[model samples]
Structure formats: structure tokens, C-alpha cells
Target: MNTASWGSAGRFGLARYVMAAALARTADGGAVVAIVLLVTTQGGSGSLAGFLAACITAPHLLGPFVARRIDLADDGRKVIAFACVLYSFALAAAVLSYGHTPAILTGLLLSISGCCGPLLTGGISSRLPTIVGSDQHSQRRAQGWDVATYGIGGTIGPSVVAAVSSWASPGLAAFCLAVAAFCAAWLVMRLPYSAPEHGGDVQNVPSAWSTIALMVKDGPLRRTLYMTMLVAFSMAALPITAVHMTTLIGSPAASAAAMTAAYGIGNLTGSIGVMLRPLRGSPDHLMSVLALCVIAGLFAVMVSPTLLIAIATFWLAGIVNAFFFAATLAARTEYAPAKGRGQVFLWVAAMKITAGSAGTAAAGAMTGWDVRIPLIVGIGLIGCAVALSFVERSMERF
Candidate 1:
């Protein structure tokens, strides 16, 4: 009711949710970096590094199950709060496993922690409406704030990992990530808690599988999901390309930091642009912009002769990435049915996160071929996605 409440959090936000989400996203951003560092520190090979990363992300595939439960339950916050605690403990175990345990055991602990990713990202996302109410304008602003905070977290997370790992150790970075999750848990506890049956009538609640089926049956939502998956796939090239380019340029690894900074700055800038002037158009229009950004960004990386050019291009791509996601979140908020919103939110999160992970891993394999080859493939996929969006428009006219 009062704009002041949201205003205090900065940019029309819920302070508590924004704080918790920022912490969660930071952990999400850092955990992979920490995992790689830990594996390498432990004298493990690249395969093990990839495997541990998978352990952390693979659980996203099952995120929908918890999201479904959250939707059907009275209060989703309880599920999220519990997940927060679980991640803290599980990640701690992962930290312990780094020395005494084998990679498999460490990975097992990471997998346990990974289950919390979806709940933290998508599950918490579903709570936005509860905090901000359903008014379109207010909700979009809140979502934009969310996007900005998420970018801020992404920017901070890796920096934290790199700094901590360099000065102290990779193990310490993992511990810091756990502390972030613990802090997130504490923050969630401060939020208004509700019982599990907020919606009432268990019999009326549909299963997650059925909801997913219904969602896919919709033409626009399905198309949007498919299109975004392509963007996610392309976006993977950013990290892989950054790592490779650093090696190629023989520049200090810190050069990669500049690239990341550019991306983060771009994301914050783009999110504000969306919040300032919300676009009005079909989802196809939004997806087209997203795809174009991916195409241009990747192409820039492929052709960049110097590290400076790559940084500039990455900055532009980051702007497009942030804009694409902010606009898409608002669109998803608008399209999702009231009853099934939680499931849909998590489903989208799961799909995009998984696709991004797969893209990164796949890209890693191709670095041996040529640094630019993976990004080239990423650009082509994004272009195809853009083409598909136009096809949908043409079909609608027919």
C-alpha cells in the first residue's frame, strides 16, 4: 500500500526479499568458480572440474518438483527457508570433502546443495507478487529491481571467489559461499512466514507434471521458452570465451575481470532502462531483441582482435542480456496464471539455468578446437532462435 516501504529498499523493492535474493545469486555465481578452484587445488584434472560443476547444477533439473510443492502448499517461504538451511549445511560438507574426501564424495555434497538452486532462484521468484501485489506497473518495477540486484550479485560473486581463493584458498571461498547461504536463510526467516496450506484444498492442486504439460501446450509460452533457451545457450560463450581470451592475450588474468565488470555494468544499466521505460509489445518482439543481442555479442567476441574490443563488445552484450531477462521476467509475471505461477516461474528458471550450464560445458569441450569456434556455434543457435520468433509472427498472420 505504501510506496515508501518499497522505496527504502532502493528502486521500488522489498528490502528483505531483495537482500536474500542478492545473497542467493551471489552464492549461485561463486559456487561454480569455487568448485573449479577447489578441484584444481586438490590436484584433480579438468574432467573432475567439469564433473563437480555438473554436480552443483544438475539438481536444477529437479527444481520443478520443489517448485510444484511450493505452489500447492500454503506458503512457499517455508520451503525456501528450509532450502537455504540445507544449502548451508550441504555446502559445508562439500568444503570438508575437499581435503579428506575424493572428488566423488565432494561432488555428492555439492549435488545435495545444488537442489537448493531452483528453490532459491525460481521458488523465491514466485514470492514477488506476494510482496509487491499484482499491479502491473509496481510488479515490473520490482522485477527490474530484482534483475539489477541479481546482476550486482553476479558481479560480486566471482570477484569474491577470485579474491578469496587467491589470498586465502579456494576452500575459504566455498566457506564464504556457505556463509552467504546461511545469511540468506536468516533473511528468509525475517520475512513473513505462512503455513504450508495457504491455498487450501489439497485435492484441488494439480500435479507439477500436468501443469508443465499445460504450459507447453500454450503456443506463445512454449515459443518464449524455446527462444530463451537459445539465448541461455549463447550466453554461455561469455565465460568460456573470457577464460580463453585471457590465455590468448597473455594479459594478466585480471583482464577477464574487466570483461566481467563491463558485463555487470551493462546489466545494471539495462535493468534501469527497463524499469524507467517498460516496453509494450508481444513476447516475440522481446525475444527478437534478446536474440539480436546474443548474436551481436558473440560475433563481437569472435572477431575481436584485442582484449579491449572484447570488453567493449561484452559490455554491449551484457546490456542486452540484462534487458532481455528483465523484460522476460515481467512478461512471465504477466503471462503466468495466478494459481500456477510458482510452478511456471521455477520451470522457466530450471530450463534456462540448465541450458546455460550445458552450453558452458559444451563450449569448454570446443576450446581445444579454437577459442572462437564455440562462440560461433553459440551465435548460430541464437540466430536460429531469432528466426523462429519471426516465423511465429508470420504464422500468426496466416
Candidate 2:
């Protein structure tokens, strides 16, 4: 928070953190796509591709446990750096073992990498408060940039995979992810060390279950986490639903790409909006409003008669969703105790990922019946979020 601390070195430290976090995120986001492509190219079935991807993601369930270790570490950055290095090596090993070694071996390697995935997401985010200090303005500014990395990774990660796969081999493309993660590790090592407040001593850290109970017992945090899961449930289905909608509307399948692209652009725009003019009012209220707007946008997309209308609506929904994401981050920062902040972030993120995976699977199963069904399902999920928001608000009156 001190401008004196934020000298040239501090500015560069922030830059390094951004770059490292972004690269790590790109690797995390692209790993599944690369695995799918690599496995399929190696004469494996779609089922194998899916299995490998699941193998990589299943370890994310350990996020809470991972965060406990991070919170207890004397220097959390060292833990993150180590995780990045381990992740990079595991990915590289998986690529090498795909064809030459046993299939189960490769899965094990990927699962090892997946165990470290939380450090790239929630783990990195937990450190932001420490890095920027307790200054509200600085925290908001840094949070905007930190949130932007997710959008950037979402947009660029797959693109990088596609480009690399086309130019070289799928194995090479997968290996590139390893390289990116390694670069992130190198960058992480350069960051100024800042330990979590009241988080250094082993005895000071509470149990992960305590954090979970806190999330449930705290009104705003509970509402925020629940809403996050609800939104993720719907948002995760978008890709499958978008492709299905293209089929139903008699549009080219490539139109799905346009719709997703629009959504990505909208997300980036919203991140920039956060940086330029951060949202006003309580993060809890802002979350509710932004979620409602997302619901409206999704409803518009569902009723759209043409592909262009759907694309535009998707973009609008994306913008609102980005703001919703920022609100959630703010809520966590405001409500979570310093001792368990890492666990709070990681557990919340783990829940989101798990919910998203379930939603994706549900959409895949239901889309064959009718495209509208998935969109309806998505809208219904957001409706639950809105209802939860109102319920939380009303409970405060009592």
C-alpha cells in the first residue's frame, strides 16, 4: 500500500506477478484441450481423451488441502514456485509417456500436475492481497488486472494449442504448455516475497473444514460462494449449448466460434472496465445486480431468432459475468479471515470447477434432446442464484 515500497522494483514485481500468473493460467486452461488432442492423435478414442482430461482435473478436489499448506508456508511464493516447477515437469513427463509408456502412467503424471493446479488459480489470487498491501484502491486495481488473466487465458490458451498443434505435433503442442508453466515458475521466483498475514506459523492456521464452515455460516460469503457455483453451472454449459444452438438454427457450426469469441471479447472489456472504474456499492449487492443482468442476457440469447442475435447476447452475458466474477473476488477479500483466506479462495474455486464439470456433462447429455433445453437449464440455474441473493438479503433484515 505504501508508495515508498512501490518503487521501480515493486512496479516490476507486480509486472512479474502478472506475467507469471497469466502464463500459469494459460497452461492450466489449455492442459485439458491439449490432452484431448494429444490422446486422440495418438490413436486413442474420444473416451480416452475424456478420461485423461478428467484425470488431470480430478485432483483439483484437493484444493482446500493445498491451500492450507500455502497458508501455513513462511513464504507462500516459494510454495507456488515449487508447484509451478512440479506442474511443468509433470506435464512434460506426461507428453513423453503418452505413446511410449503405459496409458495409466501418463494419467498418473497428469494427475500429479493437476494436484498443483490450484496454486495457479486460487493460490495465486490469495497472494494478491499481500502483494498489493491493505490499500483498498491498490487492491481494487490489482484485482482488476488479476481477474483479467483468467479472461486472457481463456481466450488465448486454446488458440495457442490450436496453432501449435497445426504447426507441429499434438505432443509438441502439449509440451508447449509445460514450457509456459516453466516460464511462469521462473517469473514467480522473481516476485517480491510476501507471506500471508497471521499465516506464517503452523499453529496459527486453522483446519480447512473450519474455512468451509465459515463459508457456510457467514451470510455474505455463503451467498457469494453459492452464487458462484450457480453461475458456473450455467456458464460451463455455454460451449456445448452454443454448438447445439447452431445446429438447431440452421447456422454453420463455425458460428459457435463467433459466439464464443464475442463472449471472450466481452469478458476482456469488463475486466478493463473494472480497472478504469471499479464497481461502486457493496460487492454483495453488485454481485446480485450483475448476476441478474447475466440472466437477462442469457434469456435474450435463448430467445434469439438468428445467430447474430445469439452471438451478441452471449457477448453481453459475458460482460456481466466478468463483473460478477470481480464481485465474488471482492466479497471473498472482504469477508475471509487472513488465517484462512487461501483455503477460502481455493475451496470456492474447487466448488466452482466441480459444479462446472457437472454442468458440462449435463449439457452434453441433454443437448441431443433439444438445444433450448440446455439454455433453459442455464437460465434456471441463474434464476436459483438470483433467488439465493434475495434470500440472503432478506435474512439480513432479521
Candidate 3:
């Protein structure tokens, strides 16, 4: 494609994809928050809330295999479109089925929505390089846009749910989420059919599990995967911080929402950084710095128990996290074999899922031992990640 053609495709594709991503994120965040709140209101314990949280991360464990399958397909465009539609319908069904009597069915529907989550995210990651432009700079910029969209959507979605839940009802919040999902599906439907350039027949395609095994055997890919998992585990501190601030410090829901908003702002800012200047140093070096910054931010959280201070610290942590995550993703994408891009991204998603599930479960279990226990553990893990970065640097040089 010519420069003009590439630019036009990127503009059009980004516009539509961002809409879809934002809606998808809004649905995902709003549904999780709303479900937890509803369950609690219905006299359920924190265990139920934790289970719902786990539901959100559980599908990630399967994302790698899913990505492999999607990647092997000749028609990724169709797969993405179908997934979007199915996801939308599922969210809508969950919204419509909300009530006290059919609680079990409602939970099942919510879990189903979670299962569709990775398919959309992974599909987009794989599709963007094809549709936007193949150049590394252009591809990075496109991913930056994606990151910003998630931040904006994530920041807004939870606040919307919180507002609706407090003023109206959880059902209303869920309904809004359903509408967002439908909008995402509509936006996705407009894109041109773009698939991986490495065309091959289905009969020759490798199994998803085999692809994952091959990726794992690659040293840089494995290191990157570990880094992603650590970063994700560290982020578990975010929700835990919110819960702590509300339960222990007597902070209002607005405070939690503001903290989240600040975190989103940090992510947006980091995306801008990625667009403006390339991290000229090695990925390991940059990631090491980011890891230390993350630890510093977590420590800040530990010391500052008040609402405003906590919010500021969380926002700073978010900025650091944005840099860390964006850099890691860019590196992973750069290192991935062209044919294995989808599987690589899928592995990243799976790591995130595994880390998030572990972190949340641990956090929920240790909620009694000081609400900030998870944050401490997060800080320690980032420390380990920092150490691992040095090892990665040496490996790279060799």
C-alpha cells in the first residue's frame, strides 16, 4: 500500500476499531463491577464478588489456544465479526436476564460474556498490523491508539456503572453496557476483510497448542511472557486499592472512581509518549526502569493511606504501568515471527489472565490481613521483575 492509502486505512480502521474497543472495554468493566455490586447487595459475601472477578480473568487462560485457532483460519475477518456479534448478544442477554430469582442463570451469562472477551481483543491485535500498515513505526502508533482507547473506555465505563448503580440500579448499568456492546459490534462490521499475508490451507495448519509450545521455546518470547505476567499481577493492586480505600479509609465511591480515572489518564499519557518518542534503549533496560518505578509507586501507596494521596499515587503508578505495558507489548510484537503474531499476542493475553487470576485470588483471601497486603506483594514482584530484566539484558547481549 502507498503512504496515502496506508494513512487512509489507518484513519478509517482506527476510528471504527477504537469505537469497537471502547464499547467492548466498557461492557467488560461495567459488567464486572455491576455484577459484584449486585451480588453484594443481595447479601452475598466477598467470596461471591471474588468469584465474579475470577470469571473475568478465567477466559484468559484459554486465550492462547483460541488465538492459535483464529490465526490458523484463512478468514480472520469473519471470525472477528462473528465473535463481536456473539459477544454483543451475550451481554444483551445478561442485561435482560438480571433479577433476584434467576441469580444462577445471570451469573452463568456473565461468565459467558467473559469467555468472549479475549477473542475480540486478540483478534484486533492480530488484525491491526494487516489493515493499518506493515511498517514498525506505523504499527506501534496504531497499537498506541488501541492502548489509549482501552484507557479511555476503562476509565469511563466503571464511573458510568457506579453512577447508574447508585442512582438507578445495576440492571440499568448492565443495559447501558449491552448498548455499548451492540455499538462495538456495529463498528467492527464496517472494516475491510484483512487476514494474515502468510496464506496456507487449513489442512496444513498447526494445532494451537503446538504453536504455543514453539513460542514458549523461544528465549526472548518466554522472557517477555514472564514480564507481562508480572506486570499484570502488579496491576491487581489497583482494584485492591480501590476496595481498601472504600472499606478501610471510609473513602466514597467517587474517590475510587477518581483514582481509576487518574489511572486511565496516565495510560493515555503513556500512549502519547509511545507515539512521540521511541524508547531508543533496549526493551530490557526500559522495562527495568519501569519496574522500579512501579515499585516506587506501590510503596507510595503503602505509605499514603488518605484518599487524595492514594489517588495521586495510584495515578502515578498508572503512568509507570502504561510505559511498562506498552513497551513490553511493542517488544513482544517486534520479536514475534510474522506467522506467529497472533499466537504471540495470545500468549500475552494468557499471561495476563493467569497473573490476574492469581493476584485477585490472593488479594481476596488476604483481605483481612491489611487491605494493602496485595500492594506490598505487588511491589515485591516488580522487584523480582526488575532483577529478571538484568538477566534478560545479559541474555540479549549473548
Candidate 4:
């Protein structure tokens, strides 16, 4: 292909692939929300809700190992496509069993579906650089697109599930999820194979722990991973805050849904802003600003007497989230060798999942106390993250 034709074809391909990835995320998020709501309607408790959340997130902790396996495999595309099919099956099964069994079984199925999340994310992310060729600018733009897809998927997915479940049944939501996964698998199959530049022999593949150990020894990657974990922890406080608002407003379901929607809006806006102006500063500086925005936004949400004010703050926080996400991904990609990209991203996902689960659990435990406690803790965590940015800066100089 000529240069112009190749660039055009590549851009079109990337768009198609990204849209498919976004749809998969949308299905995943939508299915979780639908399942939770379905269980609640069938008399599940708040504690059960917490358990369901944990199940969905627990798979992230296993992502590192999955990514390592993908890296060692000769056909990443086939692995990703198969995972997508498995994910579709899991969601379909969960929907089928929604009200037929105990809440625990439903949670288990959802957890299994959640395990595919990191694979989808890592697989798509690793493909982007190759699709965009060597144009650093376009690659950055692609990252922005990825963030936008995530935010948009998150926002629309729940709305679709809620609507579908309401109009038909929760099982319908699973059908939607199946469609998404199928689309993703199809798109991935269409892409030309691009092997990792820093290829490694399958016989000499490193264990997950050893891969993580290597990542931690790299100064920039370690700092970026730490920041990602802190961000995840801070974001975890959103659900806690939503719970508090629901209690205070005397409309728990309605309030939770609204707040979640608002947070998604913030994320979407942030992603768009990053696309408009990709970061020019060091990763530490860029993330510090985003952290500060999150801290301020959290404080605003905590004290807001009206839901409108809370929504506004959350929207701003979402913008910060988008910027930080793009910066972090770029930094991580830069720090890791090409061969290790999948493993690095997986490690980042693992840390975020573990920290987020802990944060959520801690928030749940504090339910008897002031509902705002988690928000306060969230602020503190963001501050600590900001402080860590400075530490990263200092380490960079060495």
C-alpha cells in the first residue's frame, strides 16, 4: 500500500477496533450493573451488593498472570478472541441464573466475566501502537480515543442495561453483552498480526511474580504503577460517596444511578480534553495536577447539600480522570520494553484492582459511621498520591 493509502486504512482499522473494544467494556459494565439491580430486586441486601462488587473486581487481581500468558503465546489475537467468547458466555449464564439461584452464584458468574476485563483492555491497548505505526502523535491521540471509549462505554452501558431490564428482563441485558463480545471478537480477527518487537522465547517466559519484580525495579514504571493504584483507590471512593448520597437523599437507587452517570460524564469530558491537548509535562507533574483536581472535587462532593452540586464536582473529577489515564498509559508504555507491554499493563491493572477492592471494603465497613468518612479518606489518599508524584520526580533524577 502507498503511504497515504496505508495511513488511511490504518486509521480506519484503529477506529473499528477501538469501537469494538469500547463495546466490550460497555457490555461488561452494563452486565454488572444489571445483575446487581436484578439481585437487589429479588431481595439482596446491601452487604450482598458489596460482595457482588468485589466479585466483579477480584478478577483484576488475576490479570497479571493472564497477561503474561498472552505475552508468551504466539497468537495474542486468538487468545483475546477466545477470552471475549468466554466472557460472553459467562455474562449470558449469569443473566440466565439471575433470580433462579442464590446471590452467591450470580456473583461467581459475574466474577468470571470480570476476569476477561484486563485481557480485553490489555489486548486492545497493545494493538494501538502497531495500528498507528510510528507516529507518536497519532499514538497519543489513539490513547485519548481509548479513554473516551472507556468513559462512553461506562456511561452508556449501564443506561442500556437499566432500560433493557426494565422494558423486557435482565436476561435481555446479557444478550446485549453477547452482541458486544461477538463484535469485539470479529474486529480483532480482522486485524493483521503484529508481533511484539521485543520478542521472547516461550521456553524462557518469566513467572508473574518475577515479571512484577522486574517492573518494580524500573524507576518510571514503578512510579507510574503506584500512581495508577492511588488513582484507583481514590476513584473507589465514588461508590462509597454515592452510597452516602443515596442514604441522605432518601432515594438510594435513584441517587446512586444519577451520581454514577455524573461520574461517567466527568470521565468522558476528561478524556476529550486529553485528546485535544496531550500532556507536555513529565508524568509526575501531569498526574499531580490530576490528583489535586480529584482531591478538590471529592471535597466539593462531600460537602454539597444538593445533588446538583455533587454532580458538577463529579463531572470535573471525571475530566481529571481522563487526563491522568492518558498520561499514565503513555508513561507506562514508554517505560516498558515492547516485549513486556502486555505484562506491564496487566501488572498495573492488578495493583489498581487490589487497592480498589481494599478501598471499597474499607468504605463498606465504615457504613455505621458518617457516610462522608470515605470521601474524607479519598481526599487523603489523593494527597498522598500527589506527594508520591514528588517522590517519583526525585527518583527520576537519580
**C-alpha local distance difference test of each model:** 0.79, 0.84, 0.71, 0.75
* lDDT-best of 1 and 3: 1
TM-score of 3: 0.86
Please give, for residues 1-398, the per-residue lDDT of candidate 2 as tens digits.
Answer: 46557667766777888899899999998999999999888789998898899989989988788788777877778888888889999999998898898889999999999999988888888877766646666677777888789888877888899899989977887788888888998888888887556744678777888889988988888888888998888888788878888877789999999988888888888888888877767888888888888888778878888998888888887888888898888888888888888899898888888888888999899888887787788888888878877887897889
For model 4, state the Cα shift of residue 387 in Å. 1.7
Best by TM-score: 2
Q: Which candidate model has the greater lDDT, 3 or 4?
A: 4
**Clashing residue pairs for model 3:** none
Residue 195 CA displacement from its true place in model 4, Å = 2.1
lDDT of 3 by residue, 342-371 (tens): 777767776776787677778777767887
- lDDT digits (tens) for residues 374-397 of candidate 4: 888778877886787688678678
Off by over 4 Å in 4: 1-6, 42-56, 97-111, 198-200, 203-205, 243-257, 303-307, 395-398
RMSD of candidate 1 to the truth, in angstroms, is: 3.1
Ranking of predictions according to lDDT:
2, 1, 4, 3
lDDT of prediction 3: 0.71
TM-score of 1: 0.88
Residue 152 error, candidate 4, Å: 2.1
Number of backbone clashes in candidate 4: 3
